[model samples]
Target: MITEQIAKDIWELHSRLFDHRPILQGHIRAFVKEFEEKRGTREEDRLNKIKTQLNDMTDKYIPETETALDTFLTNIQAKVKVAVEVCKKIEEKENNIEVGFLDLQRQRRREEWDVFMQEQFEKSAKVDQDMDIEMKKVSAEYEELEKKIEHISTATP
Candidate 1:
């Protein structure tokens, strides 16, 4: 009995082979190459010979173990399924690592900007403090000068 999974796998391979014609010229050539390999040497005699052999085998042996081929193909597909899942996991992890790298870069930039802004703010604050101290000294000197002029004017008068 042919299972549904076998049918689905066959459909997938058929679709890849027939329904989805590849876009690249190289891929088309590769397909032709593979077909020629399978069809035997681009010669009619070779193809006919292969056909006769296949027919002979089918007539002699295929009836006796029909399910064996299907089971073997299905088992190979099961192994392929595991490999595909592992490859998907590896791809996902690689994507996550790329995202993490970008995020880390952004974080470092943010921290650098914060440090630069903090340094600018500190410099501004220091300048303000120095201005305030200078203003106080100037005010005190101006007051003392005013009092001296007033005393000198009183004495002279």
Candidate 2:
């Protein structure tokens, strides 16, 4: 993208010079030629310096960013895993309580209530699992974007 823009800018500069053809005739062309050569050399040097700076910036950030991402992912994964386990344990305890209540109400018509409660518990578990999965996917995508941003910032002047 930067290359294309640079090419377009150069073309526009050339076109502007040609548009004033009469004014740029004879000695004017020689003078413009010298000026352009000097400008081109200066621009090249500037671009090289900018490229070096970009390289240095990228070198400074890449490893630090990678380490940060790795640490973040590990922390999030560990926390999520712990949360899911705790949630599962809580769900099991709730299920056991429901079962015990159902047993006590076995003589009564509580079948519908038992079924509804079980269904709700299952739905809640499913929702929790889905949310965790979504969060993991989002985290992965964020990491990828970070990498892409770093690559683009480094590659472009």
Candidate 3:
């Protein structure tokens, strides 16, 4: 459950980063395009005005883009840390549950040494196998998530 929540949070952060990236890119592209188009125009005064407007837009948006990128990175870092912690907690919980099951099996065997040993052993073995499988799956998922987060962190827009 915690892993799922972490995944969701990470995905939401990824979505927000992508959403902001296109807006920033569009603004920058527009400023460049207008500046380029006005460069060869015969109207000096109009060209100067357009250049000034483009500069102003660049000045405004560059800082905003930097800040947004910083915020996005910080958010992703925090979420990844949280996800790692959640995975650790889940591993701990699984260990505790396994131990508890072992104790229950011992108690069951003690209560009826001959009657239920085979059934209990088989049940316990099956559960242990299932838990092992689940742990492997969770580990693989966590690894994949970590890789994705790393890619997101290092990727250039």
Candidate 4:
């Protein structure tokens, strides 16, 4: 008789547990939903904080980066300008050197021509002097021969 009562109590407990399963499941689902919502909220808050920090960093550094880049570009431009000026100076010097060389060459050629003309003038003067001396000698010899012919004619008469 006692065993029979224990078996009846056990069967009633099993029936109650089965009847409450749907309610327990509903509560578990509600708890899970609440937990998921809280987690999502925390994650959103963390992400928003990261976004704000990133925005602050960009705001703080963007102008500095732009200023540095501008400074670098200005320096490069200045250097380029200086380089161009230096190149022009170098070109001017080179041109001056070339012109000076040409001038020197022209002066040397002029000097050479002057020396050659002086030499030719001296040679022509020497030739003219020699021709004049030969002509004078020939004229004196012709006069002596004419006098001899006249004397011979007079002696014959």
> Per-residue CA lDDT of candidate 2, range 45-153, in tens?
9999999989987898887899999989999999999999999999999999999998878846577788889999999999999999999999999999999999999
Q: Pick by TM-score: which candidate is best?
A: 4
TM values, all candidates: 0.40, 0.31, 0.28, 0.41
The positional error of residue 100 in candidate 4, measured at the CA in angstroms, is 0.8
* Candidate 4 lDDT by residue in tens digits, 1-157: 9999999999898878777877889999999999999999999999999999899879987878899899899999999999999999999999999999999999999999999999999999999999999999898899888899999989996
Candidate 3 vs candidate 4: the lDDT winner is 4
Candidate order by TM-score, highest to lowest? 4, 1, 2, 3
lDDT of each: 0.90, 0.92, 0.92, 0.94
lDDT rank order: 4, 2, 3, 1
Alpha carbon lDDT at 139, candidate 3: 100
Clashes of each: 0, 0, 0, 0
Error of 3 at 14 (Å): 99
Best-fitting candidate, scored by lDDT: 4
The deviation in Å at residue 2 for candidate 3 is: 99
Model 3 has an lDDT value of 0.92
- Tens-digit lDDT track for model 3 on 12-45? 9998976787788999999999988877575877
Worst 10 residues of 1 by lDDT: 17-26
